[model samples]
Target: MKAAFLIPLLAALWPAHAPAEGVAGDFDYYVLSLGWQPGWCRATGDRRDARDCNPGSGRDFVVHGLWPQHERGWPDHCATDERDPSRRDTQAMADLMAPGLALYQWRKHGRCSGLSAAGYYAALREAAEAVRIPAPFDDLPRDITLPPAVVEDAFIEANPGLTPDGITVTCKEGALAEVRICLTRDLEPRPCAPDARRDCSRSRVLMEKIR
Candidate 1:
């Protein structure tokens, strides 16, 4: 369904009372952010979690979060009522998320998505599947250094629907952290808003090894 139609249809079917922070479904599109796991582990060093840091994990980018964002601002934790995510919903996202991230993401961001747990997660999975990981990035032979723009270009080149403005490269301590891609709620590429576009000021950043 078109995002324009789906948002209003959802709103009418299940009216959401805005939380103290802001109204649910007030956002314009979604940001499907994928974290470079090795960079994350290396940047944090000792603070790394077991799943992502496991030496033989053979993982590269992992789902960071699928966020609902406005053109200029973001709404988070917008649900007035809290409910536990079903185990089925949590398990459905397990392959894409690290341990504990599924729950945290649902509470912190998904609740504000104006979608039921099943619908929201299904959309998230679809968005993640829509993008193709650029070669070498999908499986890096060794740690390499590249400009943030290069990383963004790689993704844009790999994913037919993406443009430079539709994606932003994020870094932490000069290491590639995440690639945040803007998409309409229905999962079509679009330019990220100014707020979502702001990130990683460094001229170059490290792309850590995937072992």
Candidate 2:
């Protein structure tokens, strides 16, 4: 009877331990996150020090990350045999994301992509180029408060193939933060996974003006 009882108990516990280690390049889709530069600088109090936050940077929305996503969950820090990115490799992405972020993303998410450092960064650039930034955000003269859905709608309107279900807007401290869009491995738009479709439900959120 003890053997029978132990067998059921172990079966119950197996699933909890099964997915602790993710397999590289084994994901269902991708999430391309675009951050609002002005909101990030204001929220983080990064005035003149950071390159992207400095005056005359002329940046609005910048690439935050290109994350591999499962249909229901995500992976990170998976074990991989790929070589880590060199300093020069990371620096090449400075125009879109910080060098530190490029390095960190490579170690955490990129390693799980089953791509070499060069291949992963190249894919990141391709993903960023797939989305079009809505024009209104380029010339906002002052702060504005709007529902996060409006932001999602703007992105959908700008990108011909993107839909409301494929994009989400996130908020931070009652301010507009980032927009996350779902894409297939080939970089085509797709509906986000249930767990990944996080919409900021605030009735209105602050969108800081460009500095």
Candidate 3:
């Protein structure tokens, strides 16, 4: 009985490739840099003027957030990245930063060397947990119909672990679906989510329909 349960348990907890070590932390920092200040800037609001609200276009992605919805990408800047980073190269963000923007980086975690904990981490954890199986699909409402991107993000949020190195989406247990997502450099920190996650409410209806 234990073996039977353990098999599915392992499957539920497992990732296809296990991200590189130490790089998980690095990838996490990358996520942090993005969530705080996303790099992608597409022209939003006022087509007549078509002014850049975030101005992510042509820039490397920097911020992403699930709070105001992850779709907005990075608008808020971290307290540390704003002040310092592991290596200082103004060329990377000359257009974004001012002549004297405070710059700081933790080097390992993209945080400053020493500063009080901000609990801002509470959000990034979502990205970490999204990379797992049997995540919180039933909790979200089915009526909402979350997009694949949102569902994938949720899986990583629910079950975070050792990210892997390879990147591909093939048919697994369910023959459900697949979508290409931008992966990390070496699959450290194992950013992965389950094959399927729907608005919990919608999944419930699906279950009913199946029944």
lDDT (CA) for every model shown? 0.82, 0.87, 0.29
RMSD of each: 9.4, 3.9, 15.9
- Candidate 2 residue lDDT tens string, 39-138: 9998774854676777777778889899888886678888889989999999999888989999998887898888999999999999999789999897
Instruction: Identify the leading candidate in terms of TM-score.
Output: 2
Any runs in candidate 3 off by more than 4 Å, and if so which?
A: 1-88, 94-145, 148-187, 191-211
TM-scores for every predicted model: 0.85, 0.88, 0.23
Better of 2 and 3 by lDDT: 2
Error of 1 at 132 (Å): 0.3
lDDT of 1 by residue, 150-208 (tens): 98988888999898889998888878899999999888999998778849999999988
For model 1, what is the alpha-carbon lDDT of residue 107?
Answer: 77
Kindly report which residue stretches of model 2 are placed more than 4 angstroms away from their true locations once superposed: 1-20, 45-48
Q: Model 2 compared with the native: what TM-score?
A: 0.88
Which run of 10 residues does model 2 get worst, by summed lDDT? 13-22
Residue 48, candidate 3: Cα error in Å is: 19
